[model samples]
Target chain A: MALREDQILRYSRQILLREVGGRGQQKLLDAPVTVDGASDVLDVAAAYLAASGTPLFDRTTHGGFLAGTSLESFAPDAVAVTPAKGWLGSFATAPTIDVSLFRLAVSNGGLIGVPGGMPWPGELEGQGSSDSVTLGALAALVVQRFVLGLESSLVKVRNVDGRWQRE
Target chain B: MPHAVIDITSQVCPMTWVRVKLKLESLDTGDTLEVLLKGDEPLRNLPRNAADDGHVVKSLDTLGDGTSKLVLEVRHG
Candidate 1:
């Protein structure tokens, strides 16, 4: 989706952060995100997360399954089952305790598409130790670059003996 | 670090990765290239392709608005 002007302004806040600044923002505006899944929900959720700050999520079963399942199900189940109130108790407690569980369950059979997964410290660290706002600005800059058409130029070169020549 | 920045926005598919490969070849080992691009296809594909070509993707970040960027460190083959 195309970004609006207000988004640019709002995201400018992220750009202003020392870690991001204009250069980092430009870098973000130019980055790419790959979403692999059958459903668009994961894609949307990913979009939301990317906008929020952290980016990168495998929309596949393996990746999403862990986020949607383990976090949404197992964690909650372990907590609910501690009281031994049975399946009904687990169900009753599930919605109240963690809204993400209910949201994931109602949205799909499994937690195929839920937002706010584990933050990728590696990627964030790459952006430097900026605050969430700065990170968000960096993300905004990335989106801007994406819309602006900032891509590498490819020119094929042929090899003559050992040296290379552009084709 | 003497990083080279390539703005490959609007470009698509093989072209995006191809240009990146070309730029890396011009640099010596341990050089860094900051590639900027758009589109989901390239965002997902280029990093893997870079790795296959022996470049290390130091980081890949996507803006909330849908744009993306990748920082690749070049290692001589």
Candidate 2:
């Protein structure tokens, strides 16, 4: 379906991007994404996905995060419906290294392993809010790229001595 | 080879250009698109941005009332 006037205006900024024109915006609105996992991470990702107009599959876990908030308050086009086939992913934190991870395995079995050494229990405990936000943002970005069919590669970030190291 | 017209009078600076760009993307190479808009920012910026994207600005005219019409030719490279 062609974008409605409200949608055109609502996503004007995103449509302005060369990488995400009107067609991409339409794809996002039509996309049905399933986001499930820890509430902290799920809430942030769901908010962005909603704002982008990506429809979310109605799952009990999703409702757990959106119970109090109205999705329409921020996303005029956000809709949650019966479970549908679409992009799917989850988020989890690596307690040993104090890092949040997001991965989607494609046709070929993707790599699976933590690159850094393990830490003793309670050493990397107490993951902060910032970590959850970062993980959620990354998850949303990956979903958008997948919906738009954009070329993207694996990204890894590890917390090394309280500092982030990219590999 | 083809000609199209789109009115973006209600749209602002960036969206004005965005709508025009999308129209251009839908047309074939050498196709002409006429955009109707109302704003100084878009009047000044759209033509340049369209040019930067390899499209040709065929003409731009002010229609007396407050609207301006811009004509562009798609040039994909």
Candidate 3:
């Protein structure tokens, strides 16, 4: 599909990057990225990724505490974020592209703090009032992680000749 | 069989469907794609959309809190 005008403008910043030039941009538009998570988490990520010109397949449903469970269900080629439980027993396997995790707690009336350990940026201490904004921020953070390569973490366990090796 | 998984937590409409469609296209004929969605709009629309697109919806499991996981098997000839 040809790039739309708004798409070109919205993703201009990304397109300008050496790694994500016109070809990359085209790939993004053509390729689909699936997301599974809580409605708020997936919505935010999908909106940002889509607006930024990446075709998205958002599979976020209404319940479930962690988004990773949702991702595990869809089984996309790559996942941006997953729930905590999904990370278990699969630490050694990394997505071909990237995966992200957005963490948030509903407190006072705002989302705050983007902890370094989590993929989603920290909530803003008390910024949970507007769920939409919170979702948007989380989505933006996921995108940032994707761009910065912060989302891709390869957990390695040493094995010598198929045997466990001590570090 | 090739399987694709997506995590769509904390997200809302349009985006949910958009992501699903993209994943569907990536699969080869006879492959299956599963989607975990957690919103009302998406829960209502994703399966319908997938069916409309000619994919076979294998299953849709709904949880108590209103979240759902949909399994779609690509059926391109």
lDDT of 1 by residue, A23-105 (tens): 44444433323334423333333343345332333434432212433223323321211211232223323211111322243
lDDT of 3 by residue, A1-167 (tens): 54455554445666544345444566555444545544555555555555544444433442322234433443232233222234233434423222234433332223333424453322432544355555455545545445444443322223245332222
- Model 2, B1-77: lDDT tens digits are 23999999998877778789888878889899998989789889999989988899999999978899899999975
TM-score of 3: 0.34
Candidate 1 residue A115 C-alpha distance from true site, Å: 53
DockQ of each: 0.02, 0.58, 0.02
Against the true structure, candidate 1 reaches a TM-score of 0.31
The reply for model 3, stretches above 4 Å from the true place, is: A1-167
Positional deviation of residue A79's Cα in model 1 after best superposition, in angstroms: 76
CAPRI grade of model 2 = medium
How many pairs in model 2 have backbone atoms within 3 A of each other, for residues 3 or more apart or on separate chains, i.e. clashes?
A: 0
List RMSD in Å for every model shown.
Answer: 22.6, 9.1, 20.6
- Whole-structure CA lDDT of model 2: 0.64
Estimate, for each residue in A33-83, the C-alpha lDDT of model 2 and write its tens digit. Answer: 655433555567677777887776544464322332645566644654212
Kindly report the docking quality category of candidate 1.
Answer: incorrect
